[model samples]
Target: MVREKFTHIYARAADRKGGEAELESLLATPLSAQELKGISDDRWLSAFTQKVFQSGMSWKVVRNKWPNFEEVFFGFDIEKMLLMPTEMWERKATDPAIIRHLGKVMTIPENARMIHDAALDHCSFSAMVADWPAEDITGLWRYLKAHGKRLGGNTGPYTLRIMGKDTFILSHDVEAYLRNIGVIDGGRDTRKSLQATQQAFSEWQQESGRPLCQISQIIAFSQGDNRL
Candidate 1:
């Protein structure tokens, strides 16, 4: 099984790095259910927007200006964002507080509407995210891509990880590892590749009793980078 290959990689990484404890240090602890529930929907929106803007830019830049982004976006209030005038958004294209890219600037309202619609249907965006089964977390990624604007590719999964969801990030390193082990055949983001990755994670979870986040980090760590 793929889990055995991954375990061997982990063992090799542990040996090179001194011990299993060092490998553990490279992993981030996923948020508990209570912790996840405590996070507000607005915060989820902020996280989503952050990931969207960080897509092709330096995350450090986005992170550094996040406080100003919070102020300019009206604290990411869903309703307010949904109703914000076009002129304000246009004006923000020149704002120093946030990334001034017009295209990225435009996604704010569209994504806000996406979050608003999800909240309308599921009570709250946070609730919708909190309710999805972690075992099929890739399905959540699919849902976000289909329903939310600018949430395609790894953005949705990364956003989920940022929100403390027990999800995996199929980063290039992880994908390469999967391909090397034959869990997947190519790097294409097609449904087949996604399903293969999802099934592999499912098996690993059942075999290891670990969340997708930790499994993903382990796979990355197994590659000897240990920086996930």
Candidate 2:
């Protein structure tokens, strides 16, 4: 039997998705803080670059060429990436080995610089991210957007989650659910809307003790015509 209280969101999602077990299986777990802190800086830079390239492109295509990207980028070594000359970048752009978008290729150096700077300041970039409170994940989003190139919108959130940070992406379904429930209004990226969405998620977390990732997923599953 489902309780009809604050946890109705969980109940509704479970009901629509077959049962609680099914819903649990559908949710992805975020990496723990200590595990996240253990990830190397180069891997972080590599993941960020991958997501940037995949943003508006075919994920399959990008994935197929990822090995070349690693080779060309010198395994995403922070110091080596910083030392890569502008002319080398141009040559790499012309290489058939990887996706040759100059603008996107150019973004890598800037993001690497940002990550390297964080590493210098906080002992390691992963440490800084691991230390950040999940309750204000949006602050981390804003900081990354202001500091890193091409990291605004879903890019930063997506990369953070991929790197094991416990954050949420405002996927279309999640945005639609937020709006339909009046937790948000107008543009999903607006400050007012994000604040409202954050508050709602925080309240839900308090009640259910679920990670923000799962809560975000549940909110999306509980709404629209997703019943199955």
Q: Write the per-residue lDDT of candidate 1 for residues 197-221, one digit (tens) a residue.
A: 8888888888778888988977776
Task: Report the CA-based lDDT of candidate 2 relative to the real structure.
Answer: 0.87
lDDT of each: 0.82, 0.87
Looking at candidate 2, the ten consecutive residues that score lowest on lDDT are: 1-10
TM-score of 2: 0.94
What TM-score would every model get versus the actual structure?
0.92, 0.94
Instruction: Give candidate 1's TM-score.
Output: 0.92
Model 1 stretches astray by more than 4 angstroms: 1-6, 224-228
Give stretches of model 2 more than 4 Å off: 1-6
